[model samples]
Target: MRRFVFGALAWPPLLERVLGRAADLRPARLPGYAVYGTGGGALDPGTLCAVPDGGAEGLLILDPDPEDGARMAYFNGTDADGMVTEVRCGGDLVSARVALHDDAPGDGALPWDQARWLEEWGPLALDTARNIMAQYGQTEPARMAGLRPYLAARAWARQLARTPAPAEVRMATTAEEGVEILRDRPGHEGFFRLRAFDMRHRRFDGAQSPEIGREGFVAYDAALVLPYDPATDHVLLIEQLRYGPILRGDPRPWVLEPVAGLVDGGEDPETCVLREAVEEAGLTLREVQPMVRVYASPGYSSEFFHCYLGLADLSSYEAGVGGLDAEHEDIRSHLLSFDRAMALVDSGEINAGPLAMMLLWLARARAGLRAGA
Candidate 1:
């Protein structure tokens, strides 16, 4: 017999443990089960069902056990769709399986019993369920493909969870400051304005088109840097956790990016770059060689990054652990020769789009930057 796990309906702490373990077991698909689903309420049974069914076959549900039925009260109020969704969203199933060897919950907040599992997990479980299900829905094998509606059902369940949390925007003084704000408001939307919002204009009939905003919301209104040390033939790249890759199922989500951060209120972009360089990567940026200050992304997010080229002591600085501890930043700086860094970008080793663009910018200005250095 094969086994699968669901964390949503299981319990909160248990679910976290399960996800952590699941993360540990990389590049492997979890087992699938079935849902005797009946849908109602804010939870989308469809989305919940997709996790097991989409990735593997018939793993979300099992035949009702007479001995277990009395314990499965949470399944009682739910329909077949709801039961299955509860299971997927609950994630206890996954939690129970992956973390079976781990210690039981210290408190009653999460119970080991199956019936109590659904109650504790609740509709709030659907978000993680939807995320996992969506990942598998696109990739599920054919036999399990029929269970796709569970993904939809899970989505509905998530809507119910949303009623409680709701979405709201928070304000901040600067982009980095906005990161702090965003960290606090994990689920809710964040909105803030910073001093310098950079945009490029494509002249059309001598008139620039409506500006495009790159990156995400301009929540962190800050400056950007494209650091280059032509004398040392080196550049500064800072690595940190990124939400974009996290959403895309990347295991190691930290990305090596240019020395960039939010420009605090009353500070100029150049000042922001210099400060960020010292704080994030532990490098002293001496000369600021300005480049086209363009928005990183102009479509969805409001992050307007001001790109620049800075001359620094690439060899003197140690390329090791850096960043602010209060913010829980574990950034690793790489002081590589220009050719090596460009090669990494060219070979697709450097995945971040902004870093790639900045690298190319440095490539163009390498000669001049070196001459001046």
Candidate 2:
């Protein structure tokens, strides 16, 4: 059994999730050390450091579950930096251990604000802890720290999926009526993840289906843009090597698609498209028209995309190579006449779904879009 003095950053619910049990946090105070935000941002978690006469107000957790000690290590991190020390709580000095991280804000960087953190970063941190703790023995602290933002984004996406559309389908698309998730478990972890499910759901015609097991490829929601120029009557397409086609044994794996990228956590779909435009094709977006927001594939993946029709001047645009090297993206852009692009779609040459959908949607809305509306 061991006891620790948590600082202002100590999140009780978060720590409980990390330890996989119910933990009671008693109000406490610690002296001789301080906690501050790591450089990662106000939301990146905290960095603890030793200081003279400085004190931290937090909670106390004693005798944590032993089964999750290794898992807790990733959160508490190695005690290599901080040491066993004495702190005062309610006028009583007690002995406890403290752990600190080297990188990020340490002492004197930013004053610890528990109330503000709970208001602004609390939910994000708690959601991120769900995935971070699930990795447990499978990953290291540094890697987890780097993945914090994306993990939080992924958690946000997962929450969005859980929100049922209000009364959309009377028979019950909402879990309260027809669906129930019995067990949900994480399968793999990394830049992308796979989640497994075992559950039962309602079938059409008022019958319940037997329990069925399933899994889904968890991917961040994305934003896709099909740049179009009415004055020039041209549309831009980006071609790149896609692993899905090659893996599926398609003879031609170089798939042509729009300027698209995954949406970062807390970013707007419109902003994401504009950012992707510059990164994928070096195009400056003047105006953008939202086409539709949809799932990439409902059967096997949770990937959603916000499609857009970006209005831009393409008269002087030239076909060339562009893409961010950090992501290993080697892309080539092609400007095709509206007629020629549709011809390719008809001939089955343009098979990428987002591009195809945007082309058709543009065909329907072209007249209004061209009229400067």
Candidate 3:
């Protein structure tokens, strides 16, 4: 049987990755259907929905292997339904399968803009597709849906890793110049991922080190903000039960920390911090100050932090419980004087590293901020 598939939002590179070969594509148009954008959030790409009447233009794949068709279905995710339809290809109407979604747009929904999507989301989508397709026959669609966010975070990490930091005082060598990766494989995948690598790197003495095996936790870029009221000289901190300490067998797992969240793929750190502030503490920030960007632990993890100081009015807001119910977050916000926050740091009460660092940072800038306010 000859198989054909129509792609409206699928980029050529993604199709190539999924098919494991160059795709045989032709320009085609679905005469009685329109493509609309649906279901993307800060962390994921919006997908396409084909609905009756208005028409859409896309590429048609000719004679895709049955296995390739299955792979494409997985890529489309659980929300998509494939239907055999006729599309105009050149001068003739040809039979092809198109993916449609149940949540079709109603009146006045804008048509899907392929150009804008390519510019803003192409890289992340491609990187995410690579990770998704790597699981090919191994992962189920329902399981893959749950894994998408983590995979997107990993892809975003890879994107951020491309920009080099200042290296004047350091080795001044890029990863390309310093490290030679031999084999990289997945150790585990869930809410987090563990990756094992066999690699070699240049030593300080100008010699290539022997190949060695190592493993690292794949994590996300996080935005951390210490909300401060310059007029009141107080700061807001949230207390939450942390899983890391629990895993480490700590008696006290509920720790006080800055309002923080994982930066969604393609989301700006400042924007993420601002959004997290409202979600975690119910306070809208008046201004935000960039504190520092650093690796949480460079030794064996990919976790990084973009820290900030958020200026807000603390006098009107009281300490209370706040957090998104969807995430099952039981967060308690605490409003305290600057001195009291520092006292917590001094008394070992504020054990979270990022929060403590941000507090100390706030101490140095407190005088100027108050004067300016």
Candidate 4:
């Protein structure tokens, strides 16, 4: 039994929850303990005068004035030197203070009878008690003491405001492909990949492809970008050689595409779009506006595309040679009016999906942009 000096404070519900959780993890898993109060003179009789080495102690304090409803509660912790620990419960963070005193025979503060404080308010105190117990002497206690209620309220608000979207699917396409290709395929060590491709209606399952074995193709997130000029109404498109075109047996191997690049690990979408804008087109954008976020081929591939319409001064920075030397990216840019670009899309010269989408969107917004209306 432990001594608790409850001063004009009624027990709250938080204490019960904390003690219930702590009871499961009590020191050495001992028998159930008891909690009472100081009685007779100014305290209740159930208070314990001496707390055992592995027992628990708690205190409840209330303002003496009737109009004052503010209260403070504390848990007497025995972890280190019988220290006083603080915890947050019922919008208040209470700190427990501990002290040792002699049991004088006729002291007015000593209790005459043992009444059950636990039975009346035990369950109510569980949450607060467990919180304080877990945070004994930890930094969390001090932090909770300052703005416990505000944090609770904020958490509630966040819960209410949160709208979770569908989770991105992650499938392993080629962890071992990199190693296998390094040993067997020897030529393209610089670009070893396990790519996921859509096959919604196509008969090409990755299992059937000779390119993959037991280590099947893993799904990947797609990266996309778009370049636009609200001022000149001119957009720059890049023509480049792609491995996919060669694999597909296209007579014209080079394909038309938007100024885009594959997103690398640890890179944000915004950063990637701007970097790709410069690398593929030699154009530095003032501001990039996000237009749409879509999956390139959602039914069969895990590649999601992030499209952006970059606002830039395209008058002077056009028809420039740009590409990373290491990547062997011999990219050429064609700067033309939005109408002409769409005309190319209408003529099948522009075959890339992202480039076509951006051109159509630009067509819808072109009249307003030209009239400045």
Candidate 5:
């Protein structure tokens, strides 16, 4: 039997990739329905939901192959369910399958705006789709849905990685001129992703190096902030038990560090730090001084940091515990004198590298900041 599906929110590039070359598409319209945005992160307004209206315009896929149908199901995830419906293509009435949003709210839904969405979310959505489809045969659709947020974060990391940096002291050759990716073998997919690459890069002497296998731990870009009070010479640090140290066999896993959180897709780093300050330590920061942006580790990870010095008044604020319950965070906030924080750094008590770097940065600017205040 020939199969036809109506897609109201399907991006053309994504549709081409999912439906394959054998499928055909044409303009179509469904009567008594209108599309609305769902407003989710990552692929914001994740998928458009249909509500009763005079009509809605969309695309009709004609005779999609069985494999294409399966791939489409996986792409839509578990929140949408498929059903056969009739839509008009030109003068003809066509029967097609439409993916309905199962939990679409009845009121206050905004109309779908494809142009705006494409401007802000198109690239990230495409990149995220590439990762999600790569695991089609191996991962369940429901599990993939659960992994979508993390996948989107990883995609956001790629976008942030494109930021141009000073290359005066380093080679001017670009990745396009210096490297070749022969193949990519999938390794793992969860909160974090792992991928192995077979590649070669141009050496300084002008010859391509031998192709070798290398694996990378894909991570999100993080916003880290050190809250400081120039008036009292105090800083706020949060203590939490981290998994990395525990995995590395450290007996004392609880470590002190600056306020930090993963930068969500389409979110600015400055905005992220301010939000983290409130969530991690019940502090509302009005403004932040930029510190330095750097990679946590360049050798085998994609973790990057946007560090900042948050200006706040900590003279009367008492130290206490704070963290989001949904994230299972048990964080304790500590208000320490500038000298006391440095003493901990000297004693090797403050082991987190970002925190140490930020404290040193504050030290260099402390006198100037205080003098001005």
Candidate 6:
């Protein structure tokens, strides 16, 4: 049976894997069915259902081979278990099948936009699929669904680190030349992944260190902007519940922090901060000044940050609820004068590292920035 991919299954690289060859996609229609989907990441899902007078527009998979059918059954959740249906391919209404999910969005579900999906989610999903397929047979589809969200984010983080920087300097040693990865495996895959490694690296003394056992948390890059009203000398901070502290059993899990978010795959950090400013704070950013590009904790995580001081007119913006309903972000912004922010810092009410660092950086550069504003 040929697989007819109407959703993310059309992701090119993935399509090639499923179809053996990336067969030319042609205009096709499926009648008596409506396509519905819900999922932000690979974990979020899609399915097709029977609906009278409803049809979906998608590409037809020409003549899939037996191998293609088998692989499709393995990876595409619906192919493995979804109900078989009929689709109109050219003049013939051939028998086809779809996997349906109950969680698929209904009523307001937009038609599948293939180009948009490839642009925004293609890269993340591509990498996520590779990681998932790599651990195939050892894990179940249910487990992959659970790991999908974080794995997608981890893919973005990896892409960020892989972003090329203009030549400024060259290191004496690169991972290729100085490090040998004997065995590296996924230790855990959830909101974050635990990666266990057996490797050796060059030492400062020009000798190879013995093979070491180490594990690290695979992290994604995040955008952090400290919104400063250079004209009024005020800064805006956000407070939200954080799971890290709560999981640690800290008395306070609510964190006071900057307007921050994960940088989507193929999105630049600068653009990410601007997008986040509106989504998280309902404010537009102007003249964003770069603070630094550094790892949150280099020793054990790949979480990187593109810190910035975003200029905005927060003179009227008040402490209020913010964040996206779909993502369940319940954020509150606090407009604090320089002194008030400092008081919070002094009192430990502001404990998030990014908030504290941004505040400190602003204190020293406040005069320089306002001078230009």
> Per-prediction count of colliding residue pairs?
68, 3, 0, 30, 0, 2
Give stretches of model 1 more than 4 Å off.
1-218
Candidate 5, residue 12: CA error in Å?
1.2
The predicted structure with the larger lDDT, 2 or 5, is 5
Superior by TM-score: candidate 3 or candidate 5: 5
Q: Give the better candidate number (1 or 5) by TM-score.
A: 5
- Looking at model 4, residue 123 earns an lDDT score of 32
- Among these predicted structures, which one has the highest TM-score? 5
**Candidate 3 vs candidate 5: which has greater lDDT?**
5
**Candidate 5 lDDT, tens digit per residue, 100-202?**
5534545666666667777778788777777777778888788887777777777888888887678999998999889999998868866777878999999
lDDT of 6 by residue, 48-148 (tens): 66677878666666665656544555555433645566778788887655554543347756656667666667766677666556555666766665555
Candidate 4 ranges with C-alpha deviation above 4 Å: 1-219, 371-373
lDDT of 1 by residue, 188-247 (tens): 211221223334443435454564433333243456786666778877777788888889
Total clashes for model 1: 68
For each candidate, what is the lDDT? 0.48, 0.75, 0.79, 0.49, 0.80, 0.74
Question: What's every prediction's RMSD, in angstroms?
Answer: 18.2, 3.5, 2.3, 20.6, 2.2, 5.6
Best by lDDT: 5
lDDT per residue for candidate 3 within 29-81, as digits (tens), equals 77766666543632222334546566677788776676766777666565454
Predict model 5's lDDT versus the native.
0.80
What is the C-alpha lDDT profile of model 4 across 230-272, one tens digit per residue? 7777887888888787899988888888777655432456787
- For residue 57, model 4's alpha carbon misses the true position, in angstroms, by 37
Stretches off by above 4 angstroms in model 5 are 1-9, 19-22, 45-53, 67-70, 102-108
Give the runs in model 6 whose Cα sits over 4 Å from its true position: 1-125, 134-150, 164-172
Q: So what's the TM-score on candidate 3?
A: 0.92
Q: What order do you get sorting by lDDT, best first?
A: 5, 3, 2, 6, 4, 1
Candidate 2 lDDT over residue span 189-244, tens digit each: 87678889998888887788898999988888888999999987899999999999
